[model samples]
Target: MMTVPSKLQSVNLNLWYGAFWALKGVSMAIRPQAITAIIGPSGCGKSTLLRCFNRMNDLTRSVRTDGQVLLDGQDIYASGYELTRLRKRVGMVFQRPNPFPLNVFDNVAYGPRVHGVRDRRTLERIVESSLKATALWEALQNRLDRPALALSAEQQQRLCISRLLAVEPEVLLMDEPCSALDPVATQHIEELMRELMQRYTIVIVTHNMQQAARISDETGFMLLGELVEFGTTKTIFTNPRDKRTEEYVTGRYG
Candidate 1:
């Protein structure tokens, strides 16, 4: 059997905030149609790595990057590549659930509209399908006209996800998506992730080890700014390659 190419790859990646290096020579290949979780203590460059996938860090005034990030074998940082298109292809969800003050329907339709989707029927179908895919259709079905900010935090987060799905991104980068949710809501999001991995390539930055163990196929452990170990979730949690990974995962140190 022939193996498929990686969906995303980084080679000798380094990110700098002015002169301070945030990510130091980090590199990895993410398999397509799988969930890869980046786990580490706070300020360990987990989120920075996720931003590099779609070049989100470019928005920061002091940020500079060296090395290459390839998506489907193409270098995204090369000249003539449109950052707007790149970002649309690689969607992101932040730590908190931030829904707009607009109505629920418009919130999910925001991306499509900005991308020039104008037909009422087309937008409706996209909204319904996207919400259904995130498992929020039933709860949000009747209240499409209500403001998105009125929903619970978890619902709002799911709405944000639905918005991303509306655009049909090939890759999803989630930075601590479930951190603010309660246990029940967190479980729902976790279940949603498993379902999502069947279709979209996902890279998640998480602090919860059990959540990583439950959801990820591959786990990357980072410390300070270095990737200490990266392997199958079982190996990282049970038998890590690096001593630092073993200590961090086993609750010996952060």
Candidate 2:
């Protein structure tokens, strides 16, 4: 049998924020073109581990890390790796909808603009395709010049995703992308995530166990900054190997 290579990997990864250990020795292989969810109680390092994939944690002044975070078998933390390029390939969406205070077209076109694509036709095509991918083009096509912030909560989140897709990323790191939306909106975003996994490797950090179970192909359960268990969503929720994971999944304890 042929095995699918990991799109991203963490090997004995550790992280600290000003001497406070946030992520213990956590290691996992993220399969390509699948949704991998990290579920844990608050402050258990779910978001921290998700951020590590794109090196977003480096923005925090007090943060430091050790061990390897590999993208396509190459260590992303290597000295000569270009961070801008890494971020372009590994895009991230935050917990809240944070569309630039600009129009929809500008928000989706921002990344390509920064990457030095100044041609009007290229930017227009990228913006249209990205919005279409996120299912926003139909509703917002006539409103491309409208402010992104004026969109509904769900639209804003989808628009944020469109912005990431505009950059043509290979991996998408979502840190609770639906946390700010209502249940209906959350379901829409979840459906979008499911569709996106057909083309992108997605890792999501969600506090909602049900959401994790519903959308993830694989799930990782974390406790006290350590990955207590990692397995298929079915196994993790129904037959978790660790007592901690069982308790957490069953609402016995967090």
Candidate 3:
């Protein structure tokens, strides 16, 4: 029998910001074409760990890391790695909807254009396809000329996701993608994630355990920068192996 490889793998990974340790000896293997949710209380390293895959933490000063994070068998932290390429392959959606001030079409087209896709027809196709993938095409198709910032919070978030898809990413890192939206909007984004899992490896950091339980194929529990438990969503929610995990999931304490 053959085994499918992990789309992203973190091995004994540790991270720090300035003098403060953020993640401690955490390891995980994110399978391809699936949704993996990382859950924990506030101040835990869930967000820190998500950023490590695409090296988003490097934007901060005095950030340091130990051990390895591999993307498709290649070590991302290896010397002479190309950041642009890595980021292009592994895209990110932030906690807030941060669409550009440009029109809807332009916002989605920005990524491909940056990657040297200059042909007008190609840019149009990419924009259309990306918006369609995120289920924003129908509503925004007639409003392509309107400013992306003018849309509702949910629309803006979906637009941000469309923007990432234009770059043709293999892995998606979502940091509380629905934290700022209403319940209705959050459900829409969750449904979109389910659709996206057909073609992408998605890793999400969320504080909402219910959201994690509903949308994730697998779930990991973190506490104080340590990964206390990781397993199937059903197992983690229904029958977690660790006492800490049970405590968090069962509403005993977070």
Tens digits of per-residue lDDT, candidate 1, 154-224, equal 99999999999999999999999999999999999999999999999999999999999999999999887
Question: What do the candidate models score in CA lDDT, each in turn?
Answer: 0.93, 0.95, 0.94
TM-score for each predicted model, relative to the true structure: 0.98, 0.98, 0.98
lDDT of 2 by residue, 1-254 (tens): 02888999999999999989999999999999999999999999999999899998988899999999999999999999999999999999999999999999999999999989999999999999999999999999999999999999999999999999999999999999999999999999999999999999999999999999999999999988899999889999999899999999999876
Model 3 regions more than 4 Å off? none
Model 3: per-residue Cα lDDT over 1-254, one tens digit each? 01768889999999999889889999988889999999999989999999999998999889999999999999999999999999999999999999999999999999999999999999999999999998889998999999998999999999999999999999999999999999999999999999999999999999999999999999999999999998889999999999999999998877
**In model 3, how many backbone clashes occur?**
0
TM-score of 1: 0.98
Worst 10 residues of 3 by lDDT: 1-10
At residue 108, give the lDDT of candidate 3: 96
Model 2 steric clash pairs: none
| Model 1, CA-based lDDT | 0.93
Q: Show model 2 residue runs off by greater than 4 Å.
A: none
